[model samples]
Target chain A: SQKIEQNSEALNIQEGKTATLTCNYTNYSPAYLQWYRQDPGRGPVFLLLIRENEKEKRKERLKVTFDTTLKQSLFHITASQPADSATYLCAPSRGSARQLTFGSGTQLTVLP
Target chain B: GAGVSQSPSNKVTEKGKDVELRCDPISGHTALYWYRQRLGQGLEFLIYFQGNSAPDKSGLPSDRFSAERTGESVSTLTIQRTQQEDSAVYLCASSVSGDPSNQPQHFGDGTRLSIL
Candidate 1:
């Protein structure tokens, strides 16, 4: 079965701690992957993009790692704040510039 | 605003009625897309447009759903004989280019459609 999914549906962590979310794919290898953050009642916001050739990408306190061999991507938020609570979606797509599908996402809560 | 814009943020209509939702993507963006997000579910792609043309309409759920873009800027999604099952947030997004490898999509707040 061809699928890209986040391992967890929801996760809770203490503020200032490091939060990690995982996305795994089967039966396919995507050339790149992107992560988005969505708040309730609002559209998703673009966060980061990682290519397969690259092992990891980082911006600010966020880091994303892509492993083609394992077909998995890990998104990390260091120094997480309560404001960081939101659903994070992962989109792994082929080189095509057409429609892009996304995983259901993992809702993260940073408790102060 | 410099971001994508969607009008009639909320709409309530009786089932079987025809409805139209409009989207104004950021100026200079040539790649536009529409998606449906049901409560507690992930977004489902509805359609994709590059400039004034749509290369992929396969994601559209049915003939009842139709969309058009003009001037490569504003797009409208019209659903005829709307059903209760169509109650969902309709989202619109646009990118500087069609390639996801290089561009990130900027999304609007979405239109919340309620079928009575």
Candidate 2:
């Protein structure tokens, strides 16, 4: 069976600091990986995507790195603010499969 | 352009009853998907449909779960004899095609189902 794991523990960080989240997977080689931000009672919003062949991808204050050798991906949010608090999910997709297998996700709380 | 949209944003039903969830994909999108998210858990793939081809229903948990897509547009997920464990937020997403390596899926505010 394939499994995706994110840091299940909640992360608390001071505002204006950098927050890093980790995602690891076993028994799968996804063609692409993606990150999504989900707020309470809302659907996940697509954030950034990185391909297995790509080392890194960035969008504004967000950055993601995919290391196929380690089967891990790291998501970083810089200058985090209180409004940036939400659960971050890492999803990896297999080629020709429309669905993505998501990790458990990490809850990030940026305290003021 | 409109994003994916789901109806009956919230549903509460008795156990053993049947429930149907609807999803309207973005116009012109060739692929649609359904997922389930339990409280405090990650999204679980449920089903996938591409164009007019047969859907990939491997992810459905049991025979009680089924879904249908018409003309590459609207879709419906039906659960028969719902169980308490079936309570979760049912999500629907769609992309220009079934290949996620090339296109990103657009999600809709899911229908939160509560089986009492």
lDDT of 2 at A35: 93
- The residue-by-residue lDDT of candidate 1 on A1-112, one tens digit each, is 6687895558999999999999998888789899999999999999999998999999999999999999999999999999999999998988875877889899999999
In model 1, where do residues sit more than 4 Å from their true spots? none
Candidate 1 residue pairs in backbone clash: none
Per-residue accuracy of model 1 over B65-91 as CA lDDT, tens digit each: 999999778999999999999999999
User: In model 1, what lDDT does residue B46 have?
Assistant: 94
lDDT of 2: 0.91
Alpha-carbon shift of residue A93 in model 1 (angstroms): 0.6
lDDT of 2 by residue, B58-107 (tens): 89999999999989889999999999999999999888864765577789
Candidate 2 segments whose C-alpha is farther than 4 A from its true place: none
Each candidate's fnat: 0.68, 0.72
Weakest lDDT window of 10 consecutive positions for candidate 1 chain B: B50-59
- Per-residue accuracy of model 2 over A1-110 as CA lDDT, tens digit each: 88898997899999999999999999989889989999998888889889889999999999999999999999999999999999999888787755788888899999
How does model 1 fare in lDDT? 0.91
Residue pairs with clashing backbones, model 2: none
